[model samples]
Target: MTPALLKVQGLRVAFGDKEVVHGIDFDIAPGEKLALVGESGSGKTVTALSLLRLVQNADISGTARFEHDKAGAAARDLLSLPERTLRGIRGKEIAMIFQEPMTALNALYAVGDQIAEVLELHQGLSAQAAHEAAVQLLADTGIPEPARRARAFPHQLSGGQRQRAMIAMALACKPRLLLADEPTTALDVTVRGQILDLLADLQRQHGMAVLLITHDLNLVRRFADRVAVMENGHLVEHGPVATVFGAPRHPYTRRLIDSRPTRDVAPVPVDPAALPVVAASGLRVIYPVPRPGIKGWFTKGEFVAVQGADFRIAPGQTLGVVGESGSGKSTLALAALGLLKHQGQLDVAGRQWAAGGASDRGLRRLMQVVFQDPFSSLSPRMTVEQIVGEGLTVHAPELDVRARRARSLAALADVGLTEDQFPALLERYPHEFSGGQRQRLAIARALIVEPKLLVLDEPTSALDVTIQKQVLGLLQRLQRERGLSYLLITHDVEVIRAMAHQVIVMKDGAILESGPVGRVLDAPVHPYTQKLVAAAAT
Candidate 1:
């Protein structure tokens, strides 16, 4: 057997008085891929961070021995190393690729400058040499226009391109080990596959070990050689990927493997004359961009986000929009919500979005939106009662304080949040609840006004497998009970398969195909749709 490149034993992490990661043991051979799998708050990320001593104010106790490849270099315990020695080894021997590049990367510096900084610090290269190497690194990561992109800031690049640049920086020094935390969770399906492939290729070329921390089981299955299951800070199981996934011994592991989204949505309405909650024809949304060169000095140029699109959501059916990033699915959804001005007709509840009219205020009550991230969407300052009851104030101003409080309680109850499960549920803030519970609160807020339609924007993407399953089940039950129409916008094909009756495929701001979900996904007519399906399968 090959020698272990990294070995960890009896690892524990604690913050203040609360312990997050219990004692755990694992090892990674040279060029091996190890996946630490768990849901939210399961302590998977904490374990990885502890290995690098990156967690601030964290009391970490462990024996993490890293065997360097340099001649006569002794094996060192990472936890006990001196700060100066560790700094020398951080970017040169071991590097990390964070989850969100937008937050992890410095906005002030250009991407190429960031990568060159790493080379200058660890590799002892001159500024001119480092800059050229940075561009080459970006090229190695499969980025187009590498020289030009190196000068762009983090916010200027697309999501996938930003991730590629982050990978470029992490691998600039050719580290022997890489720590990737949820690297592809924020990416679309096609882009996620591309990143995985890129990592595999680079790992093979450099013979480096990878410790991937994520909650995505599908990603683990596709990329990891060995799998370790973590539940509530405890290491439950560890084995080869085939053995673990084929016959998971622990119940938590088994539950995760079985948590793929299942179909349980309400049937489509049979009546042909049923009025649509939202109807759009020739909807076009354009944004003014600064024209390049001297033309920018004269006037602005138009960029069409959504071009001449047509779709409808019936009284009790779901219309799922599937596409890659920058494909304009969210823009289409915004137009339907009357949040953007369009060149075509968009009717919500039998009325158009007029300019500050009384009818528009009433029309807002007919539809409500649930955003992608509940933590950011829900106001942190507001209590549970205030967050859920705020909608009632606008739609039902006739109700007094006592009546509003009563309605809020009922809404919370309808979404499976009660005083029994959560003590002082009304008074507690958003941070007090877990991710799943926070999403349930978001759903409750949307359903309080008794709207005819719900615009669900990537509702379950931020959740893990089992939690995602539970949330989808909740949405299905609510839709069945309330007969709610949904304009679902997501890049997840399996989610579209399970929840949508009708599906529309979009690519580069245009609808490529539209039909029943089963027909379109299983037997796609368009090449782009087929490409999407194939990528998801892998």
Candidate 2:
């Protein structure tokens, strides 16, 4: 092991009169990879933010002594450093890679300009040199066509691309210690692996230490040398990754490690002879691409999103679509919902949507969708009652106000929301509830319309592991009770194992493999499925 690079001792952070991060201690040795693992609201992010005194308007009392790489140079306390001096060390010595790249990167400037700005400020490189270095950094991060991409704005690039640009900026000056806070949380499984691999490659090349903060235990197992678990502001466990994961000393640590998705009960068997609630065959979706200048006027090319896909979801069954970011899982969901124009046959509950509104009105009522992020899926301005009851107006417009109110209350109660438990439930807003509660509200809003098929696009991906299990259980129970079918689109193999009865592996806008959940996941023959399963197991 190398010598210590940074040591955090008696680290405490308080907001107002309440202490969120109790006194804790940890250390990162030279070129070491240390992971801080904990669930959301467990103070993992806060702890990482406090290392550089980045948290605003908070009481901080700690000694985060950072050993200068220079031989015999005295160690300085980062926590107690004066603002003027700390600014010099920020990007020049130690850099941070934020979680959400879209929010972190500048919207006004090109990606290359953003990276160049970092180099210009920290390394004092001229504009031309900094821009050249930024392009080289983007290429280093595995972003193909770096020259063109470096000129692209954050919104113009894909999610993975934006994240790579963020990494490029972080590594522009080659700092000694890198702080990554949930760096891969927003990425797909394959993309997450790519980012981690890139980090490992750069870490080896630069010989920099990494302090990773994430809740995913699997990531810690694969990437970290040592692990530390925090719960309710207290550091409960700290040891080598293998040692801590193999034998967690604290109950909280054990629970966090044990929270992986597991199949507790046998999945309910779907009758193969029964009619499918949702059916699609040779479904194809394509978007018209605009050509440059005068060529665009002559012809418009097409980009295929979902190509030649076929699947069926039986009544009271879950059909999981597993794939990476560009795999067209969500495209298939949109096609199934009649939200996009497609070239193949797709029927829902014996009927398909058509051009005529009068003809498609009945088919539209049979299917609904629950989106990925509950916060964005739900309307912030509306009250709980309004958000849930809005569906009733469209589906059962003949019903009077009194009957609609009654049905809305019943639907809310169905999803575990009751005025008895939550007083003023009808008046409460979505922001007032937790992530799990907001998802329940989303489910209620979808269920209030009594749709036979629910298109769930990464429904639990935004939640913590335990919360995901609870939500999946709730969805399963609802399916059993109401004979509802789900088209579950997600990248999580564990989630597919726990929820789906039938599974299909999608790649490059096509179905690579399709079979029973156990067969496809446990005994996958396709190389893509094999890779997904292997990654999940790790």
Candidate 3:
């Protein structure tokens, strides 16, 4: 067997008096792929960060033995390395690809310049050589028009492109080991697969070990040679991926494996007398964009986000919009919610959206939107009572203050959040709750008004698998109990399969396919839809 490239023993991490990570042991062989799997707050990321001494003010005590690349050099403990020596080892010997490239990359500099800076720092290459090398690295990562994209800033590139750029930067030094922290967590299914393939190819080319930190078990199963399970800083289990996933001894591992979204949605209502809660025909949302070259000064160019989308959500039914990022799924949801200006017929609760204008509180009362990131969506300044009952203040002003407070309490209870589970739940602020709790608060806020139609835009994307399962189950239960109509928008195919009665596949702002979820997903006619399904399967 090849010698272990990285060996961690008796690792412990603590902040002040609180120790998060207990003593844990693990090893990564050269060219091996090791996945550290756990939910949020499980301390997987802290363990990885501690390896490189990147965690600020963290009291990390461990023996992380990293063998030097130079022959005959002594093995060094990475945890005890001097700052200057660690700096030399940081990028040149061990590189990291952070979770969100948007936040990880410097916003002020061009992406190419960022990568070039790494090359110049470690490789000591000339300015022009590093710049050229940066473009080549981007090209190697499969970014289109690499030269042009290199000159673009972080925000200028799409989510996938930005991630690819991060990968390019991480691999520029050909490190012996890579620390990938949730590398594909924010990506769409197809793009996630692309990144995985790119990483695999690059890993093979570099013959480097990878320590993948993620809560996504599917990704771990697909990509990892060995898997280590973490639970609140303890290494619960560790073994080859096949053996561990095939038959797990640990209860936590079993629970995680079984946490995939299950199909438990309410049966579709059948009544000729019933009308769709939300309906749209030829829905088109167009935006004005600046034209390139001299034409931009005089007139703007038209960009159609939702192109003639035709869909309807009958009572107690879910119409799922599935696609990649920027595929117009969210735009369609926005148009349905009366939040975006759109052409063509859109009706909510038997009333046309444009006829009453977007400001019609009555129409707005019939529909509510739950955004993607609950942490950002729920205001930090507002208490739970204020956040949940704010909708009632606008839509149900006739009700007294006491009535509004009662309604907010009821809403929170309905979403499985109560004073029993969380004492003083109503008085607590958003930042006080966990990510899953914050999402529940968002749901409660959307539900306080009792909207007939709920537009959920990637509601559970930010959560761990177990938490995601809990949130999805909550939505399913709410739909069943209230007979609500949902315009669900998401990139998660499994979610669409589990929750949607009817599904629509979109690409480039056009609906490629629409039908029963079974048909669209299992036997997709369009090539693009097929590609999406295949990517999800892999």
Candidate 4:
């Protein structure tokens, strides 16, 4: 039998006074694909980081033996490797693709420069050679116009492009092992499939073992050869992917699989009385793309983000837009809120607003938005009070500071946050709050506006399953009490089934189908929509 490429035993990690990961054992064979599945804070990422000695300010103890190519060789304990020696192994023998590409990449440096830096550090390549190789790597990762895009910074690329660039950088040196932590979390479904396919292709061509850490069970079931389940820092189960998925021994794993939204199950019907208070028609948004350099002075190209998409919402209704990444779901939401420059017909609170612009205070008064990442959206320097009250300051300036404070506290209560927690939460910054709390804070801020319509762009994507359920329930309750409408944009079909009354299926900036959530999801008319629903189901 072939020796394992990577063997980890009795692995444990602890921060000061707190143990995040208990002793766990696992192995990866040559060219094998292994998945670490768990909820947030489940030690999946910590375990992966521990393999590279990247766990900071923590006490890590374990045996991690890496057996290289030669049969007769000295086994290296990766946990005990010195920094310099570990650096040598980092990008050349082992590469890691982080969860958040935007933050993982440097904003100031060109994408090419970042990729080149990896080659220079590991392979000692010349700058010219590195740049040329970087372009090729980007192309290999399925990025378009690799030459031009290589020179662009992280901010210039879309979420999918940024993720691809990160993959290119990780694979530039052809590492023997790759650690991918939720690499497809931010990508649209189509782009996500492409990236996953690329990873599988590279694994085959290079015979590299992969450790994929993700909450997405669908991806794991499709791509992984072996599976390891973790819960609250413990390794609950590990086995062949088919064995574990088909006959899940762990209750947590079974719950996760069942929690995933499915077309097989019928959606519960929401009463018509609980419909959206606002609606839109023929929504369109076109962004101008400038040509290269001086050529842009006279030439321009238009990028249509949302094209003639129509939907409606009665009071307390949640309308979900489901599509792959870059399918213009968010663009449609922005257009609905009049936040993007678009040609569309929108009615909020029975008033015409899409004809006017987002800048119109009247339109702003009728709608609000809660973004995906609360850490970035909320002001890090400001207190929770400041963050929540900012909307009131803008839309209802006539309200006194005392009145705003009372309203903010009430909003917090509406979302299940207590006033007594205010002393600690109100004065504290965003980083102090947990992921769920931060998301609740975002919802509170949106609710403070008391708008008829709220645009939620992947609000629960970053959260764990339990937190997601809680947040979903909170939104439903708040809708019932406040009579608010929701325009939820997400790739999560399960969320749509749980909360949406109407569903809009979009692709390539156009609506493929739109109808009642139950009918469309149960009997999808469009092939693309059916694929999306199927992908989510398994």
Q: By lDDT, who's the top model here? A: 3
Per-candidate TM vs. native? 0.98, 0.95, 0.98, 0.87
Alpha carbon lDDT at 469, candidate 1: 92
Q: Total clashing residue pairs per candidate?
A: 0, 0, 0, 10
Model 4 spans with C-alpha error above 4 angstroms = 124-132, 261-276, 291-301, 354-363, 392-406, 419-425
RMSD of each: 1.1, 2.0, 1.3, 3.7
Candidate lDDT scores, in order, read: 0.92, 0.89, 0.93, 0.86
Q: After superposing candidate 2, which stretches have Cα over 4 Å from the reference?
A: 1-3, 264-273, 356-359, 398-402
lDDT string for model 2 (238-328, tens) is: 9999899898889988887777676543455657787788888999999999988999999998999999898888777889999998899
- Order of candidate numbers by lDDT, starting with the best: 3, 1, 2, 4
TM-score of candidate 3 versus the correct structure, residues matched by position: 0.98
lDDT of 4 by residue, 1-538 (tens): 8788899999999999899999999999989999999988899999999999898898999999998556688879999989998888998899999999999999999999999999988888999999999999999988999999999999999898999999899999999899999988877666777788889998898899999999888899889999999999999999998999899988988887776433222233455564346767887889999878898899898888888877777766678899987789988887677666767677666666544544478778778898998888998889989999998998889999999989988888889888586566567788888888999999999888878888999998888776777788778877777767788999988889888888889899999998888899999999999888876765
The lDDT of model 4 is 0.86
User: In candidate 1, what residue range of length 10 has the lowest lDDT sum?
Assistant: 266-275
Task: Kindly list the per-residue Cα lDDT of model 1 for residues 1-538, writing each as its tens digit.
Answer: 8768999999999999999988899999989999999998999988988888999999999899999768668878999999898888887899999999999999999999999999999989999999999999999999999999999999999889999999999999999999999999999999999999999999999989999999888889899999999999999999999999999999999998999999998678567686778888999999999999999999999999999999888888999999999999999988888888888888887688987567587788888999999999999999999999999999999999999989999999998999999988899999999998999999999999999999999999999889899998988998899999989999999899989999999988999999889999999999999999998888
True-structure RMSD for candidate 1: 1.1
